[model samples]
Target: VMGLIFAKLWSLFCNQEHKVIIVGLDNAGKTTILYQFLMNEVVHTSPTIGSNVEEIVVKNTHFLMWDIGGQESLRSSWNTYYSNTEFIILVVDSIDRERLAITKEELYRMLAHEDLRKAAVLIFANKQDMKGCMTAAEISKYLTLSSIKDHPWHIQSCCALTGEGLCQGLEWMTSRIGVR
Candidate 1:
């Protein structure tokens, strides 16, 4: 009886489904990343006004994926939902060099939040299929990822249009969340 009780308690306290929040500037391919992971197809693109939530299960792990809008106005509303998130996926347009700094600032602000300090982060340098796109290393440098070097995360490159590198990003994220 004691053995069974201990097993039940251990199960209860073991790693649970991790909640992941996906955010980025408008047209950064946040939704496309999610769609590609879920449906394995790139859907029509549009700005996500508020947010889109999806539950994805792989193996024994479940992921509550929240794709949040990237508009400045929408950011105020984003704080409310960050409370329970265990991980974050930030997408950036690889071709938009001009706005890269702005994107970095926004992401920095989000990571500075006390509630999110411990959360794992995965940055998706999306739109790699486009010409003149920046590489993951360049995006990491521009975003000053080294500042958060102590934080647990990885910045991955991806081409959501053709689904290149999408699975690799997902696997990296899931691994960090103890989802293996």
Candidate 2:
């Protein structure tokens, strides 16, 4: 088992890397969603400060996911990772109840960045298990990227608390990236 682990680690160090940048507004459950995707286990987490990275392989496609800090204060430093990103995952806490508009605006601004426009975008409408939360459709409507041509996007409803919708979202996202 240890040899297998070493072989995997060795291969990772020698492989060509594919990266995905995960961004969202503060307290949007971005970290939770990332933990679920990476660790496959629920974990207690506070807001991120700058960023954290997790290496994962799904169906032999290696992924380097950068979970960037969502706080307004930390967002100013996001530009450092804009290049070489193949995908962008934006998570929003559906039950947050007040920041939906702000989330949409922030995401729009990120998408508008010249270096990021070509990145495949995926929106995770998180906390879908909560009552009175917006649906994926509602979130997309507010994002207003509905008619953006030449770019691909998907809005997936997920409950990070229970892992519901996470696998589906990841599968959809990876499939899109594979074709890109």
**C-alpha TM-scores of all predictions:** 0.89, 0.87
Model 1 poorest ten-residue lDDT run: 171-180
Residue lDDT tens for model 2, 1-180: 999999998777556467888898888887787788888888899989988899877777677999999888888888788898878889988887588787877777777888787888888999898889989888877777687665688889998888899888779866775475
Clashes of each: 0, 0
Question: In terms of TM-score, how similar is model 2 to the real structure?
Answer: 0.87
Each model's C-alpha lDDT? 0.84, 0.83
Clashing pairs in 1: none
Identify the runs in model 2 with alpha carbons over 4 angstroms from their true place: 1-16
Put down candidate 1 lDDT per residue, 1-180, tens digits, no spaces: 999999897776453667889998888999988888788897996889988988866655678899999887897787777887888899999999998988988888888888787788899999998999999999999888988954687898999888998778778766776432
Task: Indicate which candidate wins on TM-score.
Answer: 1
Candidate number achieving the greatest lDDT relative to the actual structure: 1
Q: Cα miss at 109, model 1 (Å)?
A: 0.4
